[model samples]
Target: MSVSARDALRMAALYVVLSMLWLVVAGRVLDHLFDGSVAMAVGSHLSSLIWVLASAVLIFITRARLLSFIGLGTRRRKQDSERLRMAEAVFDTTLEGVLVTDRTGLIVHVNRAFMRITGYQQDEVLGQRPSKFKSGHHGPEFYRQIYTSLAQTGEWSGEIWNRRKRGEIYPQWQTIRAIRDDQGEVSHYVAVFSDISAIKHSEQELAYLAHHDPLTGLPNRLLFNDRVEQALGTAQSHKRGCALLLMDLDHFQSINDGLGHTLGDQLLKRVAERLSHWLGAGVTLARLGGDEFGVLLERCPHVGEAASLARDVIEHMKEPFSFEGHRLFISVSIGISLFPSDALTGEQLLRNADSALFKAKANGRADYALYTEELTAHAQHRVETAGELRRALEQNELRVYFQPVHDLTSGVMVGVESLVRWEHPERGLVPPGDFIPIAERTGLIGEIDLWVLRQACSQMMRWQAQGRSLAFVAVNISSRLFSQRGLYLEVAQVLAETGMNPALLEVEVTESAVMDDPEVSLEQLHRLRELGLRLAIDDFGTGYSSLLRLKRLPVQKLKIDQGFVAGLPDDDDDIAIVRVIIALARSMGMQVHAEGIEQAEQADFLLQQGCQLGQGYRFGRPMPADALKWG
Candidate 1:
């Protein structure tokens, strides 16, 4: 019981005891002092009336105190006033919305925060249940679970979907507790919650970025690998075949180099859209870094079906993709590896597919290749060869062989194109065709290229001392080296060390290399040109060159690729291509050099086509520097 009620009870007990004592003592005194019976009765009645008046005054004071405790009357304590104000401040100032409902589950009170969050006024929500804010996203069972938890444990706190006054559904982290009376019976329910929409959205975004490519907004390698693993499991259970098609965009590096990276990123997004559109059900298409994409087909029953799918993709990509007024034509080389037959695991499947993709690119891109045991053997061989070549390069076991470049009309040796050959201690001399690609793939070509340049410069210095009549000693710079900014410095250092005239050195950069990053290549070429050296675009007809960019190149010679000269005067296509290249060279005021001349007819045909220089078996095969006896 409250202190006010106890005080009231004590006051009433004291009044009863005093009133009984007064009645006994006053009756005796009145009877003893009065002579007549009428006088004694009158005294007793008068005394009773006085005691009633005292009781009335005491009852009035106690009733007023009790009313104050129940908040019906004015408060009499300083602490009570401050405590009431403090509780009101807390309820109004808290960030989380606070709501109170009566024992009947009707909303009785809501704080200012509740009004701000739900957009409902106090008068509007009063006497209404929380169902007014139901988002309808949760079914009956969901609410039942919430009520069950609250009833058993007196509280339920979790994420829930709630509707605003505007009818928009949003998420909130809410805690609903059953507030009970002193008798342990629930008298009210209080709910406290905060908006978690922003938090939930951030979580979703983090999850998406973790497994998706930022550029393409498609599944990245991580997600792609996971889907492939899932597909393999499904295929195994059903005893069906699954195909993993690894597609690589052909010559994509050139685009990225020529165009800015921003444009490249935009193109990647566009490519993702196209891939997403073309893919059907049972397949997951993903961006697997750079210009590579992986397609996981869970139901590719046979190799033929996979090949058909690959062909369709190739054909689809053949169409030009127009972006921001640039019509770009691109092709995809797809490499397919079958499940169970080729491999059982995702890693093996991907490896086999990648090996096949290498072949597709090597055999000429815009095609498809199926994984074969032979391809795997070739890959193993390449790995072994790359290791040996690295060793050969480091151990000084590699030799520079010079091939003669002649004046086509005069049939005179004017220059020699320097080539690298690996003289393995055990394997004898390994031709460039066998190890060049390997070196390029392993990133050892740049080092080999620099070494060859230094060697060639040194050999030419010897020839200069011996009074050789050669106009220049040309060094074929690998694509890997040509793109580097340090090429000019390396060449200058070699020239300075060897004391060879810069005019006697011709650096031959391939047409493809020059076009890769034309702006950078232009600056590179100009730097070399400023050093008084000749620059030539080697294998001209093979690489697609922009005429506008080519005209800006500081080149004196254009070497027609051997592939265009193998058939020479016989093959119409070769003849036509050679004639056009020679004309193109002439038009650009560049010297035309024909390579791979074996017979007199090939040399004669090149000479007839007005080609200025020719290098091939016709003049002399590639030989060591010692073989050229100029002295």
Candidate 2:
């Protein structure tokens, strides 16, 4: 029995004994004091009264003590019931699943959350062991480690995978604690756990996004570099060779510019898929960035293997891709670099491969090239030229060369096509072909175009001041500059600054440039035309120009590409194409200007075809502004 119950029993026994003693002593005193019947009766009554009074007094005292004990016991029982109610409330309402298990690991009690999380009823798991829910992902050693930690520290918490009642495995964060009795001996284990599958899935997705390109679903630059390092390391260990191929799609920018970014993104995805399909085992293809892809070939036996793979990739790319009802043809230029032969390290290998890729692009598209030491010299020269070009404007090394355009009927110089020439201090004069593409690729072409415009306008103003009559000064605008948002404003500013008539300053844009985002081009061209400036399409036949769309363009002249003009009257195909272009331009109320008129017969053929204006070396080679003699 408990100490409080024992004390109560002892006190009750003492009270009973004391009452008996009082009754006995009172009876004895009454018998001794009375002898006669009447006296005895009175004494008996008195004794009886005394006995009754003493019994009532004893009952009052014991009742008071018993009442106090009962009240104390009732309060204690109420407090114990309240505590049990609060504990049960917490056990049922908590979010974390709770399980109470005996020392033998047998589940005895579980909360509502436990049933919700594990899909198991309280009756179902009451006598079952926790192993019944095991996903088998954790081996014997894992449980051994858990038990060891629990035994030593009396508590353990970690992430664990477990199976639900439906056999679906999921991860959970769990904490198990040993519950000890007052004697400090463990009696049961209390476990609390929460499902963390969603968190785990989110983490996995984040990891995937970090290493992959969102658009192409291919390995990004960071992952590609890591793979290259691993491939190189493996090749080194086995004394084998590996190859790194860097590829760039030819004319991808034209497609991107012509069609929209949406189509461009779709094209990239298709390219990635085709490249991935062409690659076999041990080859890793990754979209390094933009239109460029990186391929790593591990344990490549020979340089021929890399070359063969490159050819296969190129051949596969030749097939037309159909997207959104549009048939598109694309090609790839590839560059290969071998391990140990090119350079050590991933960066160096990529650099060398890129150098070879540059060489391939320079030679022409739809080709592949292996890294050569000589290509490094060319790349270094390009780098030097790029730096020199940046300083060309500041150093006054840039000059405007005007080529005379003649009126075919009168054989008179009517206008000048303004061209830019970079007079490098060391190189004397760098041709436009040599540096123009470099400038375009490096994004310096826009600034060069702007400088050319300012210089051309200034020269025209100077010519007008000298009493020279000229119809117009045509200045070539790069695609980059043509697509700029504030191009019209910049042109207006230039015209105002140079004090030249906008009508005399004709801005020349290539057909491809105007065709890219025609809506935007149309808006910009309309804005330029609003300023009373003449717009002309340069190299007209070289691009994909829709005549239906061309009818809406605010252009006044079409210049035949020099390629067709070079052959002129001899090439039948050239003659037909030139005639059709002239008819097309004339029908649209646009003037036709034939470029590259090097011979009298070419001029005569163009004149016979009814083309009015022509320009080439036959009339006058491109000369500096001051050297020009007006006729």
Candidate 3:
């Protein structure tokens, strides 16, 4: 309604009201003036005067009601002007596209926000329906569902895609409320919409960051769990088996500790790259955190194929990487769990695969193990045994065993290998293999190694006290212990404390440990040798080593790997390698011993090859010190 038109109506109403009030006042005053007691001439004059006054009063009251309703008064006009201004500001400044429709759903009112949001001008949208902005982005069923909901509830809020002025379709959050008539009928709809495309983009970005490994940009533990659940469902539908393979980089912590986290992170990226490159389209590869990765092979045909793929992955990781000016070598221990074969649920599969991984590391690092019921049992037993071992070590239940290493050239005894023997009160003797690796991983190897050194020397001294021929006492150095900074110093201290001759104390180290960093190993060996002690390369053929480098070390002896000697006579490769190693040792002016000798032929062959030392089950298995009893 226009202000001019409203004012005209107010003026007309005021004129009518004033005219009525004038008539009422005039009627009453005329009655009073015409009273009988008054003279006719005087009453006539008074009646005329009263008639004028009543006419004036009627004009004033009628004018007041009309003017007030039309905002003619100062206070009313100011308030009305302020309200109109506030309404105009809201229509112009609100972010949502708002439109007020008439009873027939025709757009009667539109705001600037509507024009901006719908890509239409005031002329285009003023007479048109809100459906003008529909982009056909929604299906018929989708539209039907939304309309049905809106009709039933009289209010609807949802996401809708609408076309813009440039014909571009964009998603928006829309709220539609039914504008009701005074008679309670839904006369029209007031729709308010906001563009949510940016919000959607932000949500996607947040999801990616949350569920992926930042270092490798690969799916992390969160996403891995989702994939596992998906793979399980697929497997059930297809009646096929899925494999969950858990792989951990062996000795990754050592690499990080020795080099730095920067190098470690770089290595992880390289590993992730290789894994992603090798993974097939159907396989899901994700980092489970740190050095751990998970692979879900959905619809795998056979368990063997999963194992083969795992092996391939391990082989790929075995390749050397140049990280931070150092040739970094990494190996993976993979554990495989098959659906229906190992477990049923996602959690079960992951747990079983993890347990298998434990076995893989236990059997040795750089290997793979398949999940089985027996493996699960072994894992549980191990946990129990670890607890027992902890208590046993604390209670002085662990004792040292001595396996005599005899001189091959003569029928004389030489050094005895010191082996740890655990005697559980109820379970009797437990083998070293059952607990050694666990101890190493649990950070108990240092103490165990020290105890072995001290006990070995003490016993060797006891033998000397018995007037028996006291020979060199050999103690195996685990990789964990060998990697320590002051290993040689610790050994020298142990020997001095035991009052054992340094010449009779031999520290045996595996070839892998020494070859890990030859320069450092050589320095440590030299330090030990300078202490009047001996350094022997233990399990000689079990690791990668260069003869050229070995010659520079302070190594005085080579112990042929039990693997090579055990299969000798029948396995030509084993025999040939053993013979060549013995010849190499002889040429280097070092003694050679054939370990794991189990047969007469093997022992005789090793002796014929100029190997002067033999330590094996054929001679005597590792036995408790009390069990040795001068045998």
Q: Which model scores highest in TM-score?
A: 2
Give the Å shift of residue 575 in candidate 2: 6.3
**The best candidate in terms of lDDT:** 2
- TM-score between candidate 2 and the true structure: 0.78
lDDT of 2 at 170: 96
Clash count, predicted structure 1: 0
Candidate 1 error regions (>4 Å):
1-93, 100-109, 124-170, 174-191, 384-399, 404-414, 423-428, 441-451, 454-471, 480-502, 514-524, 543-552, 564-588, 597-614, 617-628
Residue 438 of model 2: what lDDT? 84
Residue runs of model 3 more than 4 Å from their true location after superposition: 1-214, 226-241, 250-262, 280-283, 298-331, 358-369, 437-446, 463-469, 496-499, 562-578, 596-609, 617-621, 626-631
lDDT computed for candidate 3: 0.84
> Tens digits of per-residue lDDT for model 3 on 1-631?
8997897788778867866776677567657666664554565566567767765786678678867866657777799999999988987799988888876779988788888777788888887887888889888898788779878998888999998989889899988888787889988888888999899899998989899998999899989998899888878988999999999999886666556678899999999988888785767889999899999988777898988988888888878987567787789999999998789899989989998899898788799999989888877777787787789878999989888788777756676899998888897887778888778766787788888899999998988888767468899888788877698889878877889889998899999888876776777788889999888998888888987898899889898999998788889899789888998999999989778988878888888889898988888888866666353
Winner by TM-score between candidate 3 and candidate 1: 1
User: What digit string (tens of lDDT, one per residue) describes model 2 on residues 112-155?
Assistant: 99999999999999999998999999889999999999999999
- Model 1: per-residue lDDT, tens digit, 30-135? 8788988798778878888987887788778877876766665345456678899999999999999999999889999999999998899999999999999999
